[model samples]
Every structure is written in C-alpha cells, then in structure tokens.
Target: MDLLDDDELERSAVVANCRMNRERGLLGSNGYDRELGFNPLDVLRKPSGESRPAGWLDLCCGSGKALIEAARIVHDEGMDVEIVGVDLAGLFRRVDPDQDRLRLVEASLGDWRPDRGFDLISCVHGLHYVGDKLALIARAASWLTEDGLFVASLDLHNLKIADASPLGRRIAAALRRAGLEYDRRRRLVSCRGRKAVDLPYRYLGADDRAGPNYTGQPAVDSYYADA
Candidate 1:
C-alpha cells in the first residue's frame, strides 16, 4: 500500500472536494454551537473596548458560513471580535462587504500559521482529511492564547500504526498528560489554554483510501513511525 504526503493528500479528490460543514451556521441543529457543545460567542471576550478584539480561528473552515454568521452577530451587538476562517479549497461562499471583521483564507493548515494567538480555535470535522493529524493538533494547540479554547472532532481510529488497538489508549494518555482531553465516545479532542504537546511519534504519511469513519465519510488514515 502506498501512502501520500501532505501535499499529495491535499491534492487528492477526497480532500480537495470535501464539503464538510459547508453550510453549517453559528447556532442551530447543524451549527457550531451544537457541534462544539457550547455557544462560541459566549467564549468570546472583549477586553477594555476595541483596543484588542477577541480572535477566533476556524481551521478547515469549509465555506465559512458559521464564521460569517458570527461576524454578523458581533457587528450587530457592537462586540469587538475578529474571526478568521481558513480552508484548503479556498472556495468560500459569497459574503457581504460589510463583514469587515471576518476574513476567509485559503491555505493548508499543515503549514499555515496565524500571525496572532486566538481566544478560540475550532476545526469541526476538518481533521478527517489531514495527513498529519497529531502534528496539526499540536500546532493548533500551541497557537492558542493562555486561556484560549481549542476543540476539534477527531477519529482515533484514523491515528494508525502497525498495531493500533493499544495506540488509542496510549494516545489518549499522552494527550491528557499534555493538558488535552479526548472524549473516546464523542470522538472529540479539546483543551483549555495553550499547550506545548510533543507526542512520541513520527508521522510516516497518510492513506487516503482508508474509507469511512464514524462520520460516515471517507477519511484519511494517518500512519506513524517511532520518534
């Protein structure tokens, strides 16, 4: 079996055309609030007026609808918030020009770095297509503010190895030790504050033909060697 590197994985049909959460909103049955188990707006804090707007970074932000909706709400409420939505496809839905606080970016999360730390960072179902899931997670976590919140949906089964049954347990333990929490049943990983996570594994590559995960979507399986 052949494995694809990050660049190859990004160019693959399964990843380039992935439309996960394309139309998801900020709040609703199929929205960020429900998916994240809390209203993202509640976590957004504006300190001492507009001197420094609260930042929210949404990775793999397909279509950026949710962030756009949040931007509208912030505008209406006169809240100081800056929202950035990044997607590899870069095919974002049309938005109004009045949305000055919202920025839709097209780039690969594997190498893209934000200019500033975020108060809240989310990745929805985006990690399903990433080649180096753990490495990205570590990078995202490190990009958070001291009291920032980072949440993402992750399928542990996709973290592949030669013998992966015990890999899940080990991974969960390592994450916990690094101040990140993994919900086994919910397939979610979350953390409060910035964490410098150094997992003891090297990313070998990814298998894009691994098939469907719990999301009932075809996802990539990341392989790893030893550190």
Candidate 2:
C-alpha cells in the first residue's frame, strides 16, 4: 500500500501500528507465553560462559520483552548488568513498573546516544523498520565497548518484489530508493563487530516470527572487529 509514500513520520507510524497490532495478537493468543519463549536470555546464555556483570542494550525493544529477559539473565547470573530498552513508540509502558532493573527510553534509534557503550546490544526484529540500515548499523556499532556483541534479527519475507503483486513491487522500489538490499533465502542474519555492517531487509511486524509469512532456514552470522 506504499505506506511510506507520505513521509518518514508517517512511515514510522505505520511501522509502529503494525508492531503494536502484532504484539497484542501474539500475546493475547498466548502464542509465546511459555517460560522465556521468544526471549534472548536463553540464546545469550549459551555463549556467555562465566561472563560477569555486563551492560546490555535492547534497541527498539517493543513491549520490553527482551529487556525483561536481559534483566532476568543479569539477575540470575549475578552479573552487574544494566539493561536499557529504547524504541520509537512508547511501548515500554507495557512493562511492569516494579521492575527497576530495566530502564526504558522513548526515542528513535537514530536520535539516541548512550553515555557509555554496552557489552551487548540487541536489535531483535526491529532493524527492518529503520529507514537507513547502514547508518543505523554504524550508530549501533559506535555504542559498543570492545568486543561487545550486537545481535540483530531481520525477516526476509518482506524484502522481495513479486511480479504478481503491485504492493510488493512498490515496497521493493521504496527499498531501492533507500539504497537497501536484502536476501530472502536467509530468514535471519546476525552481525557482530566493532565496525558497522551492512544488513538489509523490509519492515515487518515487531516480533521475529511475524510478518512476510515466509518460512526458510534461520541463520546467524557473527563477525569480530576491533573497536
């Protein structure tokens, strides 16, 4: 429907609405109500053997699910970790007020500047909505400490243009205008480095498992760069 044709502000609003609707549906349906389901704590725990008390940032942390998960990981590991959740929408209100461990900030990722770099920065299911993928990655890279981790998850389903669908072609053209490119075969791609990485995709819903409705092999790619 060329939601972004109006303006950047309108585009952000459209993306935000899509995210809110999908999140409400998913949570209401109990589609991910299991213990730590869809949370990154379980994923982060695997490689962080005995890593103590590190700072974590959850960029575009919608509804603060990942922020809560990061908080749990810090508490359980007894690590002196501080968790920060930032998003364009005020979705942080959905988080419990009693959880002092998590701090939520209402700001676009492009405008936010943290005082200190984090040990780990996560952009789960939020990278695709950004207007400038490379610039965002560079900004994210700037906010990382040495050897800090940056985890991003992008959906491939919305990155393609089908001849049969006018909407799809419009989306593809918009992405081209933005100078972004994506591969649809890989469902999810993760980039970690001190320098900016070029990763691309389309704006799906706020959840990793939502939108584009295409199923493919999930992939995670990691890289190390000096700060």
Candidate 3:
C-alpha cells in the first residue's frame, strides 16, 4: 500500500487529529508524560554502551513522544542511528525544534511504504485506529529487516461489547473474519508470545492502587510481535 497518496494521507490526518484531541481532553493536559509504561528505547539499550539500532521507525507516532525518547537514547549513547516517525495527524510537526536526528512524515500506517526497512519499529497505542489491522501488521512486518523487532500495542478494553464504538466493532469483526482468536473477557491475547501477557493499562494521572478500573476504557495492550 502506498501511503503517500494525497487523498488517503489527508483522511488519515483527520482521524489522527481527532484522536489526539480526544486524548488531550481525557488527560486534561497538553504535554506528554514518560512514566506511562515501558520505554522501547530503554529496552533496546545494550550493556556495552553501543548503539541501539542502525535505523528506527515509529509507526503511528503521534506527537513524536516515542520518537523523541528514541532519539535521546541514541544521542546519549553516542549512537549513529536514524529515526523516522510516521503519523497521520502530523502532530510531530508541532514538536519543538532541534529534532535533527528525527524525521516526521505524514502517512497512514495502513498504507505507508518506507524507502528502506528498519531495524526496530514501534507502533504504540495506535494500531486499533487503522481500518485494517492485519494488513497494517503485514506491512509493518515487511518493513522489518532480518532479526528486526516490531513492537505493537492494542487496547482490548476498547473492544468491549458494551463500550466499543462502531469502528471498534468493525475491527473486532475483521479480526474474527481473519480467524484471529481474541479473549474478550480477559482483554488480552497471545498472538506473538507463548504465554499471555497482562497488558499494563494505567491511567496517565491515576494512582497504582486504583486497580484496573481503567478496564473497558481506551487502553493499549502492547506486544513485541514478530517482524
């Protein structure tokens, strides 16, 4: 799929902007926070103090938060790595300047085609928005080099039969049609790993002891899916 097409890119931007606005309102804040969950860059750090990866791609990288983190890791570790962030909303454009090592492209995860494959690809909290989840996963897989890693997250809470939106229902239907087994009760899956991993769904401002009240909300279940 070619993501650079004008019409698709424009539509994708509109959806992304809407999502960003909704999330901003939910948080009641404009700044991005780091304590949300696991950091991919930190996970990629090596003990030898060497570079992380030759190149990094942040798919559906809204506001460039993850991309910024990756760039900081590269700079602090003195790694010669290139970082590219692709998002439909164009949020990265509004980020502060001095992101020299980072490049933001307006593209849809459902259709983007990078010039070169990446050594590490991250799709954080953005896969469910795509119209075709499996197609998007296939495309991302195609963009990974051998032994490359692909990190993706999906929100099972968003798929609740009671709270799910029409789009979410459609996504669930698609997954069913594709024969992908998903546990609606547990809100978790083991598509990539042998054991099911409990997805962390902590609110941006909520306390840890608050329990999983965030369930049935728009939370992401991250996975290190094979690339």
Candidate 4:
C-alpha cells in the first residue's frame, strides 16, 4: 500500500487528538524513567541561583504534560530554564498559562524546526508516528547543542522502504556512522553530540493502517523511498 502523505497524516482528526495522559511522575506507564536510567529533571536542573538559562526541546510532545511538569519543578526550584514542546496534535493543554518559560506548540514534527539549539532534546514514544524516522533523528541531532543529548523511542521493525522492505542493519550502521547509538534491547536511539548525516532512503510517508505495536496499542509505520 502507498504510504499516507505527511500533510494527510497531520490533518487526520484521529492522529491529531492523541494524548500522552501523563501521571504525577512516570509520565506514562512506558517505564521511560527506567529506560532513560536518569531523572530528566537532573538534566534540566540549573544551579539553584544561576542566572544562565537552560533549555529543553521535546518533539512529538503529545499534550506536553511532561514538559509542563518539568517547568513547574524548575520554577519551584528557582532555576532559570526554558522548555519548548512541539506536537502534531490539534489540542494541547497548557500546564501553566502563567509560566512564560513553557511554550507548547501544536505543529507537525516532520516540518517544524526549532530556532535555537537546546541542552536536551527528547521524543517519548513519538517516532512511531513519523514517516522518516532516520531523517527526523538526524534533524533532532542537529537541534542539540554541543555535548547535548537527544533521545527517542524507536522500533527498528517499524522502518521500511518504498516497497515495504526493511532497511535492517543499514539503519544502525548509518546511525553509528553519524554518531548516534541504537540500543536494540531498549528500543531506544540516543546521541550526545550533533553531526551531519544522511541516509540512503527517501521518506515516502507514514502508514496508519498498522495497528497495535509492542505496547498493544495502535501506532504508525514509517515508509521510505529506497534506492
């Protein structure tokens, strides 16, 4: 089947209404904190009295509850930090309308780009919806500051070429060559520094027909144009 275009996917009401349904702490039941092996707040925390502002960017941020919660924590700690979140979803609630440090944007991650780099960038359970996971990873890496960290949840099997053929090892090789680390067991991709890298495939679009991922919930499949 031909993959759905990015614009079409973005306009889908079903796709745009998704939410993370954040809890008080674990964000969701995904064990994200455990997989990360560190508290996100630690990375976001600035010295209690420092004036230097730190920033974080979260892509495919869903309802941006995690960013909002983080913003509240940092604010209560009296640290200067800025948190920006972007998602394709149509409606996202502002955790704190009074907090200027937090900005939740509703837009497609496929085309949206941050104006500045961030100390940390993350996409939690977001890659599944992307049509070009590798391209987006490369783009996210570029959005990170020097020595900054970029992390996302990814399933290698969800990637395919124009013919629905999996790139398999080629994807890992490209990511490593570009300085990103893919943890197959964790189903996570991470990088600590930014580098320019290109893959051999062109993104055709996404497949929403595929249903129920490992989490027993529906997710999108990414299709690429293979050479």
Q: What's the C-alpha lDDT at position 164 in model 2?
A: 18
Question: Model 3, 1-227: lDDT tens per residue?
Answer: 11223344244433434444223211113322221234445444445654444667776777675566556657677766778988776755344455567788876554568887676676654554544344555566567665555656554433322222223344445444543334454332213211112221211111111112232223222112222
Per-residue C-alpha lDDT of model 2 across residues 46-83, encoded as one tens digit per residue: 24564554567777677765466556556667555677
Determine the C-alpha RMSD for candidate 4 after optimal superposition of all C-alphas: 2.5
Q: How many residue pairs clash in all the candidates, one count each?
A: 0, 1, 1, 0
Each prediction's RMSD over C-alphas, in Å, is: 1.6, 9.3, 11.0, 2.5
Query: What are the per-residue Cα lDDT tens digits for candidate 4 across 208-227?
Result: 87776764656778877654
Which one is best on TM-score? Answer: 1
Residues 1-227 of candidate 1 have per-residue lDDT tens digits of 58899889988887975557788888999898888888899999665654778999999999988988988899899888999999999888887888899999999887799999999999999999999999999999999999999999998888877543335677788899888999887788998999899998888888889888888889988888768
lDDT of 1 at 114: 96
Compute the lDDT of residue 1 as modeled in candidate 2: 25
Segments in model 3 whose C-alpha atoms lie over 4 Å from true places: 1-14, 17-37, 46-53, 93-98, 156-227
Looking at model 3, the pairs that clash are 154-221
Query: What does candidate 2 score on TM?
Result: 0.57
> What TM-score does each of the candidates earn?
0.95, 0.57, 0.54, 0.88
lDDT, residue 216, model 4: 60
